[model samples]
Target: MSIRIWGRPTSARTQKVLLALAELGLPFELTLASGTMGAHGHVAKGNEAFGVVDTPDYRAMNPNGTVPTILDDGFVLWESNAILQYLAMKYDPDRFYGSDIGRFASAARWIMWENNELIPPMHNLVKHTIRLPEDQRDPEIAAASRAALGRAWGIVDTQLSRTRHIASDSWSYGDIPMTIRVHRWALLAGVDALSPTLARYYAEVSARPSFDAIRDPAMHLAG
Candidate 1:
């Protein structure tokens, strides 16, 4: 399969799919489109097509003009979590997605929870705390987002205390999205404490080969 991912490596959404690819040992080309390099240019707007081509020509491929889009053997797909699920089911279905129906549903449940519960608050916190200039940042919004994040983290911590992984005893696509969010949590301000279970889980996931390859502390808001 000819696989290509378009987006900056530092993007949490991009990291989700990339981490899944790495776990599955899938070889693909990565085209950087977002961040300081700004590979896609100003035409795309708002970090769109940063890693992928957003030129008038490339827009024909993905009209939404988003980063972290993928083209696999003529199958074009966007949305980070969907891409992760596709990769797992297409390549290493038995392992990453699991073979049993109950296990697969559980894995899907956590992935959905990450998208719904974790990503929004995490994104808000990162944007207000790190992405925005201090003069422009809103402390009230950041505070509210951080509180929501604490609740989300607490839920994950309780789950981790019971199970080795989010869904199953082994790693699965469910872990990818939240693992990327954990990077933002570690960098964002106002986080005085992290649950011990979460800390241990972060350590284990951070040590993965995929995490080592793409995790970028330099991309944090202070930068």
Candidate 2:
């Protein structure tokens, strides 16, 4: 059965999963689900309404009612990074996920590192600088978060200095999350935020046709 994803298109994580699906060459359906990020099914201005996630019916399928929940055949899954690994392993394991033990571990490592080390600051930066209303925005938090993000991503820059992609010389599923987040960085912090190595890496990743999945004009820069 074709996969179905429930998530608001404006969500960065949702767009990340969409990019992964496109990269896997799989066809899927998308439903607009709302969350703390924005109004439900609000694909454009003045379209906000009660969201699917706010209903008991959606909660019955996935208790969290989170964005980018996927029903693949009978299996249900959420969390964009988890969804990325699932689709890669199930549909395109060798190339996207890597069949070798070391290779698989390598892809997983960077994905985890991205989640644990890089994402906190990136989210903080966005929350302080972009997500909150101007009156509620905190320049101090944004500045500190941006600085922390740059320091953390320095490891990525060093790694990229030696390899073409995060896990290997070629693109891997591990690169998908980072690719999406890097775009967010560029949009929020400015293109100059990237080191030379990171700039090249971003260029290569975005050049891929699958990256088009995250290119919707209505999407927010911080998302």
Candidate 3:
């Protein structure tokens, strides 16, 4: 079966999907869109490489006009985390989703937590720092988000001290979301330091070939 990913590479959510694909060694086509190209009115045509999927057309694939949507063997899916889980289960189930119910459930729990708890604050940090106009940016909100993120990082640091991976002793889907967020954390405002354990872990994960291939330093939310 063929797999296609539609999104810009710099997006953290898109990185989630791409990272899973890289980990699984799945060969898929990437259709680039949004950001500069979208702003310039270049729309994606049918299944072309590096083109933006048209909104009406993309909505047909995914009702939401969001990036990082995936098409697997004609079955369309959205949500970056969900796409990661699907790729893991379909291509690398043994290692990613894990082989047993308990393991899979544990991984799923962390994925859910990352989406609901971790990503919002992380998104806020990135958006307020870079996406918003200077006059429109809210320093108070950014400060609050960074404070919350520090607490979250502390909890993650504690967990990493005890476990090599987030969900279990082995790497699983749990690493994807947290790793992506940690990359953002390294760039976020007021982040002068990270826990030693978390910093080491981030170094290890970010150094992966997959990360090196897709992560663009230029896309980092500019200070």
Which candidate achieves the best TM-score against the true structure?
Answer: 2
Off by over 4 Å in 1: 34-54, 189-192, 220-223
Q: The CA-based lDDT of model 2 is what?
A: 0.78
lDDT of 1 by residue, 137-163 (tens): 789988998789878888998899988
Off by over 4 Å in 2: 38-50, 217-223
Error of 2 at 175 (Å): 0.4
Which residue pairs show backbone clashes in model 3? Answer: 44-52
Clashing pairs in 1: 7-51, 32-51, 33-50, 33-51, 34-50
Candidate 3, residues 77-144: lDDT per residue as tens digits?
A: 99887787788777778878567677788788888888887888887776676665567678988888
Instruction: List model 2 lDDT by residue over 43-62, tens digit each.
Output: 23334543788789778777
TM-score list, all predictions: 0.85, 0.89, 0.85
Error of 2 at 91 (Å): 0.4
Which residues of candidate 3, in runs, are more than 4 Å off? 35-54, 189-192
> What are the lDDT figures for the candidates, one per model?
0.73, 0.78, 0.74
Superior candidate under TM-score, 1 versus 2? 2
Candidate with maximal lDDT = 2
